[model samples]
Target chain A: MSTPDDTQFEAAFADLAHAAELMVDPVDSAVIHGRVRRRRTTRGALAAGLAALLVAAPAVWWLQESNGDENDPPPAEETTATATPDPTTADESAAEPEGGPDGQASEDVEDPVLPAFGDLVGAELELPEFQPDGGSLNDACPSGPATLADGTPEWEDGQWYMHEGPVWVLKVVHTKLEEGGPTRAVALIGCMPVETMVRQAVVVAGDGAGGWEVTEEVALGDTSDFPLFDIAPAATAGVLLMVTDTETTGMYEPVPVDYRIMRYRTGSDLEDVTGEAYLLGVTDIEASVEVTEGEDGTWRIELTLTNAGDHEAVGFQMTACGSDSFVLEEFDLPPCTADSEGVAVYEGLAAGESVVEEWTFTPPPSQEWSGDEDSGMYLLGDVRPTTYSAEVFVYDPDLSNNGFRVDVTPEDVA
Target chain B: MTPTRGTRHPPAAEQPLLLRPTLEFDDFYAANVRTITGQIFAYTGDRAEAEDLVAEAFCRALARWHKVQDYENPTAWVRRVAWNLATSHLRRRTVAQRFLKRQQEVHEPPPDGDRVDLMRALAGIGERHRKAVILRYMAGLTVAEIAHQEGVPEATVRSWLARGKAALAGRLAVHDEMEER
Candidate 1:
């Protein structure tokens, strides 16, 4: 036989079901086909672009080194070709710190003839307000005919077309969870010209300690694909590092070479308070506790228990351990079952799930407990091996202050 | 017109090639194009983006038409494609839209008095609960069908329905109280 509460609950659910029924319809079938087709095209394009990069990288490097002589010939170039050993020829030169056969430099390489603008071109566009809030990029321009001073550029439209490729920015947001645990961070990266094909790599560091590092690269074909990527759990504390390469091109060389890197991080410390609760499992049983008033005219703890896995718990039993100093204001539980311990449990709690319970207490007359002394600390014990895991709270009857304690003993299960 | 040895006499005049319908290609395009487009548009709430998504879906479908046509519910097949496409689009365009416009608006307030309250409760519910409510009430799907579609145990679906209903009632009560204030 069901109680009045069960009946009321069923009625409420029926009403909700009726409401949901009013909002149904069949979606247009044609539109579905079109969307699928478009997605396929974009993915195909991106794949092709990556494939091209893989194929062309080595070839481009080879071409660059071979062409370097047109600009600067080696000191031994005047020597007879046959007399010079092959090992000491282009191969040895390629291994030099000043860039070898491939024209890629080993750290100390310096260009003898620097361009007028110091190899840096392009002006800094005003960054978007929503750009990543962490990590700053280290800027280097090897072919600067254009120069930027004080974050602005001198020429607007020569080699740099107005808004041609992605303008990149990076920032980190961090979130801390639990004390002494590594904080989770979300790296934010913003790229502009939203239409240019681009790829980016981001690294996150936690409190200068080692943490998980990931790199995500996205090649977008159009502006519609901006806000290209996101990292979750926006960090509360961490350093975010980002490197971005955009494709740029010149008349004789490949247009759309990879360009620019910007990085910055939120300097604030992140504190996160997120946790998980598990139900563990349930059993059919009953339990109880007691409550009494304290000397400070507030309700004092009689007994408390917490449900810690291993068994299912159904109800609780509370007995007055001291003088009746507290009055029961109300009990809370949906689909509630009766219990003697001033504790109740709802049905259908599965294993590995948890819910928070809150109780308010009022202090009795003549008992004034200091509120400052007892905040956030609760007296709760474990009631295990039964249907419910029992955790109890006790407070002053006047809502002034109270202590909480838990009692979980193997012998207490009944 | 001369008749061939093993064939019947052809038409006196030959028809222009352009005028001749390309049955295979046209049928393929018609059956696949619009359905995917519509599904994507519904999911994204943007006409231009929907167009792009649809185009991509069709391109992929065309590449694998032989395999796709063999599926039981081709329309459903296309819808899944569109759904995936729309999700990826949303992922890339996270900050572009101020808010995700829902695929469909709530046409009428729920049968219960507190429409807004019910919606808030619905929002708080998990994806399964919301889906259950949508399927059972709005889509008129049977519990068994919902189980099949969601790949969940029937009991799980029933539980979601029950929980969703109960939550809605509590929310409505709260709403009523607020209105009284």
Candidate 2:
């Protein structure tokens, strides 16, 4: 029988597996959720700032043009009309020349005005009843405004309020997803206290009579962090690319982690089509440890860090620590003190490759270290034990399984 | 590793937004975090490190929950991420030491003597063999599942298991001898 007697291995592994079950502390998922939200909020704020810059640039240019020409007509008397041209008027303007019917600048052929933020956020429209899950809104906590007058949303007595006046509209896009389709309004609505609030992506379609009604809504969970300032039409028809801040932001330019694909049809609701095309660049690297005794009665520690992935892995740093003061509480790898050092890899590790690092160290003259030596303890001086660890820096996409550790005791020495 | 294809995920537009399930993330995290964390703990041998790695993995999963939920096995994906995190954490000293440095005082007790011995023995084996053994015995994954997870053939997994068991048995035997001495 090629199978070695596994009775003892089974028992030991079983013990380890059982012990692992006990190691888990009750995690407060809310803390993690909060962290995710905070990161998202930070990214969103950054995006919004950039968007403000873009918007301000055009305004700055217009101001310069007006300042340069004293004869330029005064800014058209502030109008109640929004940036969204009335469909009927837009058709009329398109049918006519650039100038008026009377050969003067016509009111119908005016430049598009920027919509007031107040108008976009304060428009009278019906929002879909939002439930956290598929449950009814009635089951959700009571929602109210921060106060009756201010109407700022607040949480009171475990109930959340959305004050009557304005909901935070993160983005408002007037482009239609489908070609030759009605230009519908898409609003990304965020709740107050953006970091903790779960929000919705709402699609509003204009009623034949001119009012807008929420046609569809998607409840983006607390963890979803969409970029606030950017929404672009995808090259493909009926598709909208909604940027998210899930990936690392570049130093100079904001790099979106990925886009959420929203596809819409003339008669259908907006749908999230972000499917299996969302692929992550992942590589697996396995680390193994070995210990051998030298003829000089010193222990030779050998660590084999292998690139187990099929492709070359690049841009990783390594750090190693060796110490006799190996108390569980004091176990650490930084401050490289006299006992540790960090290594960096300049080149990439090819597939199926291995990097071997070895360290030879002598134990103290006396070996009276006592304990369960088999329990990952190694003797250094009188009773102090030695522990060692080596690790590679985490890479993008997948940040796990990149390091190795070893603990040595005097018994391993010759 | 490519997970086996299962039921095709229905398009989000197919169902009305209100009717579509929105509690998937909450339920998925609650259902799998402990198990995935435990598996990573067994792999990393350090409880605090395992917890941190698993938490990071789950956070990444949450960042892409909308897309991840449509996967064939979301839990398996989370577990793979956590396991890879643990593996990567184990190989690099600075990052791991940095992570360990920030750890609060560990409230959980250390593993018993037997568990420590097992971890030590695991450290001495071939990486693939060790992973196969853990995935099989500790994770309760069948040989075929280990094969799929490892992107190896089933027979290769069986071979690793046998060799892993033999190597582990030998290491434990040595430990037993040392105890007797």
Candidate 3:
């Protein structure tokens, strides 16, 4: 005996199937084929071009010098040779400024003295205006990958190479900053290869308190193949820029150039405290609550703590608050010796940090109780002397308790 | 193309030279291009992005022709690529849309049928549910096939199908009521 709902569902499913058939056509397939061919040719051309550049660097330099007048003196090849090594090192060093060598500000010394694009003056560098070339690369290309249709390299002769690539320019206007505060509405423009999409662009504002809050997340790009041209708030000073290559070719493998940023602000300048506190690193924090039915049919509560922090948080304590109706069930902490409170504190947590702490508890058996119903409700309190923010909720079912919270308190900072 | 009839079994010890088949660009486009475009169009509700995604999907497929050709359904393979490309596009678009003063026009309801509305509703019901609906109803795939593709248990796929159908019905009913009003 099928219910009316079942019959209706079957009908809708059939209708949907029919509609899909209508949508699919041979013409669509042809378009896909053409796109694939173009992409293959572009990649092959790009690879070949890169190889040419590697081989032709000295030859090109010689050609330019030979064509020049004798008075020019060919601009000392020694300086050029010495200059190249430092910038490569400097760029690599700047890539991880927070954890860079000797804990010194590399940008201060290198930006002013660098041979190419000398001086780190923000005002001197002009923002490229928004323009659509209509499949022409005549204008100065943005710093990122060239969206030009032709395989012409965008970076040419120390200037942005322009080509008919997938590039969209967004106008950022109406900029305002809060009085006496670090500039808000600061505009941040990020450029990457069209292959990499900007995932999340956040401007972290220093909370008057000792924490950082993401004030805004700049919008991603419109075209998947084309990288984002502009991100905001266009006027915020000292913004942390981020771009994510969302190509999921190999799900397990990390995307090359997966995370890159020109972070303007640091914890020292933005943090409320005067003393030095480095941003050791960041890791995804995860906390969950488990509910299990007891022999008596009562639901029990079990709290599990996982150290998802990038650095080992010494003497870390996670306190969770939940309804008193359920008692703490069995608790176990892996990779760390269990304490009296069922807390597991590891010596250190590396990248891809994970800790599974489970608490099993029986809820009060009674008026139609299901463990899954109330499983998601748990309170997470703030982590004291906060090194990281804690996310407390059930991700499996995407449910949150109105009052449940988790607080993390740091102890004995060296 | 007709298959050649022969009693030709290559010797076990002989390393067979894999013939890199020439892909007919026209045939490939005819089979997959629009589905890729449509997937992006549906995901982003943007024509420009849909076109870009279609182009990129084909580009990627072209780059990995040997692997793509080996798949049972190359169209499905390209469609998945387009879907992923569309997702990235939307992620970037969300950022662009946030700062833009004026929003682009929402996709209009199709005049001929409620299919567009159904698709819109499917889009609203989260990616997991949308995938379930798309794979089962749109692709005409069975529950087990969907489970295998999604890497979930058959029971879970069944649950998603049930929940998705209910959610769609509820949304449609509300939409109809709004129209009536």
- What TM-score would every model get versus the actual structure? 0.30, 0.37, 0.37
Q: Could you tell me how far off, in angstroms, the CA of residue A255 lies in candidate 1 after the best superposition?
A: 57
**Candidate with more favorable, higher TM-score: 1 or 3:** 3
Off by over 4 Å in 2: A1-15, A44-414, B2-5, B8-22, B94-109
Error of 3 at B33 (Å): 3.6
- Give the total clashing residue pairs for model 1: 129
Winning candidate number (lDDT) = 2
The local lDDT score (0 to 100) that residue A58 gets in candidate 1 is 22
What's the lDDT for all of these models? Answer: 0.32, 0.46, 0.36
Question: How does model 2 score on DockQ?
Answer: 0.14
For candidate 2, what is the DockQ-based docking class? incorrect
Q: Which ten residues in a row have the lowest lDDT in candidate 2 chain A?
A: A381-390
Error of 1 at A253 (Å): 61
Docking class of 3: incorrect
- Which TM-score does chain B of candidate 1 obtain? 0.46
Candidate DockQ scores, in order: 0.05, 0.14, 0.10
